[model samples]
Target: MGYFVNVEPGVNLYVEDINPTGSKTILFVHGWPLSHKQFEYQFDVLPHMGYRCIGLDWRGFGQSDKPIDGYTYDRLADDILAIVDALQLDDFALVGHSTGGAIAIRYMSRYNGKGVTHLVLVDSAAPTGFTKDTADHFLHLALNDRPKMMREVTDSFFFQYATEEFCDWFFHMGLQAAGWSTAAVIELLRDENVQQDLRQIVTPTIIVHGIHDRVIPFSQAEEIHQQISNSQLLPFYYSGHGPFWEERERFNSLLMDFI
Candidate 1:
């Protein structure tokens, strides 16, 4: 159920499609320095519930092709469009996390939410990008010592206890990405703002953010909720930046209810 779809010449993205013929379809886009594999917990259960779960690794991350350029939000969103066309996906729920959430917002506005039914943003880095200082710090760390940066990010990911083994696994996932790609994306997250894109969205949207999120604070989520006329914000009190994994059962239940 996993394969690669060509987004452009010499650029193919890795996709994990489970329950391909299920009654409903949900397309997932992962965050920075991670792959579609980040949604392993959701994929494990949603497929059994008769939902077709499709997760794609954007270019330069996961098993996807890594090129020297095309890391901008617009280009990344175009990549999603290519997958949508290739799969002939329609009336599907779109879910995105962190930087993936920002890309999802771009996709919705740029494509006018063509085939999307419901939109979900989990601890998204959107409506606004990271501050220049924070971005600079991460960029420097990524360029010089990526492992250290990944370890720091992993440490701030969850509010709940994660085993040492689990933290190592998460850290390695970031390492799988190309260093150049990682730096390029951090730049995009610093430069690109999606407030206007939020206004263009006509799809019913839900913003699921952790109150204790250190990466993208809860205040940003509040701003996202305010900009989208039809959107609602749900705070994860007992979670940090990764409510999806920190509170998987509740996150999955919320998705089922919303979609």
Candidate 2:
């Protein structure tokens, strides 16, 4: 099933609610410059594992409404809350990747994770914001020719084993993202401090990180695992920034175990 859930006036978040027969649900939040389509692997495999998978496109990405406002973390959290309430979801696991992980932190902290039973962070950006230099470097890259920028960023950082066809598709997916949200959220990720939010995660959590991650680094995942009272770190030894693509089978197996 698909939904254009109304978040606020003139803003409807696009959500794909797949396989409704299962009793357990997993809500997936995608990373920056990408949409829930990023989790096509999970969506394809998880349903066979008896999971009802729900994927959302944030307001400014994918098929969701691209409003000029409401790009902040707090707004992102509210957008999630709107979906949770709309679906009346309970005892569901919330999975987030990259920037979405930080957004999950904000939601769990601010809302106390009311309907959530478990939390999963995949190569998340949390506990520590990006350093000024690193942030500035990414900002510079994003400001240049957008398509070329996406190609460069994907090649240089996101994947180590991705084929040319995969890279091309990934670049196109990113190019569909709103320019304003892309630029603004980079600064948001760089400047917003989420250590306190990380400390407040009461839900049983698992932090997954690729050992070879150059974009967010593996240490960031360690920091998240260390701070969350009920959290464990799961390392993707042979993967880079995107283990879901680089190591799909292992990633799926670990995720099934968590479920």
Candidate 1, residues 96-195, lDDT tens digits: the string is: 9999999999999999998999999999998776899989999999999999999988988889999999999899999999999999998998888787
Q: Candidate 1 at 164: error in angstroms?
A: 0.3
TM-scores for all candidates: the values are: 0.99, 0.96
Off by over 4 Å in 2: none
TM-score of 2: 0.96
Which ranges in model 1 have alpha carbons more than 4 Å from their true place?
A: none
Top lDDT prediction, candidate number = 1
Q: What's the count of clashing pairs in each model shown?
A: 0, 0
In terms of lDDT, the poorest run of 10 residues in model 2 is 152-161
- The number of the candidate with the highest TM-score is 1
Model 1 accuracy (lDDT, Cα):
0.93
What C-alpha RMSD separates each model from the true structure? 0.7, 1.3
Q: Rate the local accuracy (lDDT) of all candidates.
A: 0.93, 0.86
Residue range 180-258, candidate 2, lDDT tens digits: 7787777888878678888888899988899998878888888888889899899988888788878889888887888
